[model samples]
Target: TTLLRQIAGFDFPDSGRITIGGESVERVPVEKRRIGMVFQNYALFPNMSVADNVAFGLSVRGEAKAVIATEVQRALDLVQLGKLGGRRPHQLSGGQRQRVALARAIVTKPRVLLLDEPLGALDKALRVDMQIELKRIQREIGITTIFVTHDQEEALTMSDRIGILRDGRLVQEGPPEEIYNRPKSEFAATFLGDANIFRGDSTGDGIRLADGTAIAAGVGAKLAAGAKASCAVRPERIRIARDAGTPDGNANMLKGQVSKRIFAGSNSTYFVERAGQTLKVIVQNTGMERLAEGQDVVLRWSPESTVLIAAN
Candidate 1:
């Protein structure tokens, strides 16, 4: 929120430059900066109609009435709320109200759009639907958007490039796939998604588990020999079976007992105990037999699925 505020000119930075469209806006006022922002709370005027709310920006700037009417309808249509222009904020559904907030933000055709957890107030289904809608509208308008959210799934779903920040510093920035699959640090690995982290001494190629098992990690293995390192394996990449089947030369294997099981609609999660560490494994339910709690199982995954990271 502080960072967004700085860019919006609501707050000034202690030291540094804020550039929008390759131009510095250090001395620019909020309205003149040509930035549009939508808050988590929607921040709509309670007594105004939807069209009035959408036209507020252009109206404040003294735009001609005819121009404001045309732009307001266009913005409302862009958000699929064209028919609800006469309704007040209180008369609309949560999703409709959100659309009103978005329409209002984009009505003035700002150069940059800043969304601070705009969908945080919606229900899960509505939020998911809005994620797709938001992406569609963004691509159609081709506006540079900066979205801030603590929900990991939301970040992954709506981003083209993701920047993971910790304590006001950027920990990592890359395409979503790269950040999720090839994290550079333990914080980045665990923050973006669920990861089964193995901590041990590095062997240049991979890390040796505490139980003397060699786990191979071909990606991001930059640590020197005998140094403290860790490898992260996403739960979905692991395959769990009751049989200690033939070991493949290219795969890492572990023997453990299922300590717990959770049944989600489309998948199942198994907590396996091995070497004093509980590893999480997610398996999709594809008509396959399910493993029971307390059952001995063998876990296998490809070396390519493992991500090597420096221990914090």
Candidate 2:
């Protein structure tokens, strides 16, 4: 929020430059920068009708009443809230209020839109609905947008690009899939999603697990032998079987006992313990024979499933 505030000119950065639409905006006032912001709380004025709220930006700019009406209606329609314009914020549902706030921000056609956890306050079902709605509106308008949220799934679902910030520095930035699949550091790997970390010394082909098991490195892994390294694999990439044929030598395989199994409707997560290390595997719920606790199983995954990251 503070970063957005600085870019919106509500607060000035101590150093560094802010540019929008090819113009420097460090010294520009908040209202002059043409950057729209939607607060997490929706921040709609309770006293104003949705139409009036949407028109506030253009009205403050001295747009004619006729023009304001047309633009406000267009903005409301863009957000699919056109019919609710006459309703006050208090009368609208959470999702409706969020849309009104978004409409208010974008009615002026700002160069950029900043959404600060715009769906954070909504119920889970409504949050999912608004995520789709927000993405659709963004695409339709073709406006440059920056969304800030701590919801990993939401970030993965809604973004064309992603930037992960930590300790006040940008630790990683890339398309969601790229960052999620090939994170550069341990922090990036675990923060973006769940990762099973295997820390060991690099062995050119891959890292030799602490148990002295040689697992093949995933594609695109870059590390020199003898250096400390870590490999990450998502639980879903691992396959577990109770009596599958022995895997080829090229495959990374381990024999373990099912220590636990968690059922989650669409899938089941199994915790397999082998050589004192616990490995996680996720399998779709296909109504097949499910592994029970204490059952012996083999976990197998291809080299492509592992992601190498900096140990530090």
Candidate 3:
């Protein structure tokens, strides 16, 4: 929120510059920054009709009545709320009201759109629908959008490029695929998604766990021997099996006993205890027999699924 506020001119930066469209706007006032912001709360007028709420920005700017009407309809249609212009905030659902807020923001054709947790108020199902709808509208208009979301799934679903901030500093920035598959740090790996982290000493090719289990890194991992390092493997990448016999091929393997099992609708999560550490593994419910708790199991996965990270 602080970053969005700074861009919207609600707060000034302590140092450095804020540029938009190849121009500096450090001293620009809020209203003159050509920014459209939608807060977590819709902030619509209770007594006004949808059209009037969307027209408020243009109306305040003394835009002509004809121009306001045209722009308001255009914005409403863009948000898929064209037919609800006569409705009041009280008559609309949470999603509809959010669309009204978006229409209001875009009617003025601002250079940048700032969304501060716009979907925070919606329920799970509605939030998913709005995620798709929001992406569609963004692509249709082709406006530069700065979206602020704490939900990792929302970030992965909506972002073309992601900037991860940690401790008031930018830690990593990249496409979603790169950040997820090749996290530069342990924090980034576990933050964006679930990771089974194994802390150990680097062996030039991989890291040797405290139990003396050698985990080979991915194809391009490069680390000096005898350095503090860690390897991260996502839960879904590890496969669980009942057979104790070693499998063929150059796959990493571990022997553990299932400590706990959770059955979600589409998948099952297993907690396996090995060498005083609990490793999580997720297996899709593919009609195969589920592994029971307290059963000895073999965890197998390709070395390519492992990501090596240097300890901070």
The prediction achieving the highest TM-score against the true structure is 1
Q: What TM-score, computed on C-alpha atoms, does each candidate reach?
A: 0.98, 0.96, 0.97
Model 2: colliding residue pairs = none
Locate the minimum summed-lDDT window of 10 residues in model 2: 243-252
The alpha-carbon deviation from the true structure for residue 157 of candidate 3, after best TM-score superposition, in angstroms, is: 1.0
lDDT of each: 0.93, 0.88, 0.91
Colliding residue pairs in candidate 3:
none
Q: Residues 1-312, candidate 1: write the lDDT tens digits.
A: 889999989999989999998999977999999999999999999999999999999999999999999999999999999998999999999999888999998888899999999999999999999999999999999889999999999999999999999999999999999999999998998899999999999988899988789989979859899999999999999999998688688999999999999999899999999988999999999997888889999999998999888878
Q: How many residue pairs clash in each candidate?
A: 0, 0, 0
Tens digits of per-residue lDDT for model 2, 54-105: 9999989999999999999999999998898899999999899999999999
Model 3: per-residue lDDT, tens digit, 1-312?
998999999999999899999889978998888899899999999999999999999999999999999999999999999998999999999999999999898888899999999999999999999999999998998889989898999999999988899987888899998888888899899999899999899998779988898998884347899999999999999989997465566788999999999999999999999998999999999996888899999998888999888887
After superposition, the stretches of candidate 1 with alpha carbons farther than 4 Å from their true spots are none
Report residue 167 deviation for candidate 1 (angstroms). Answer: 1.2
| Candidate 1: C-alpha RMSD after superposition | 1.0
Model 1 C-alpha lDDT versus the unseen true structure: 0.93
**Model 2, residue 260: what's the lDDT?**
95
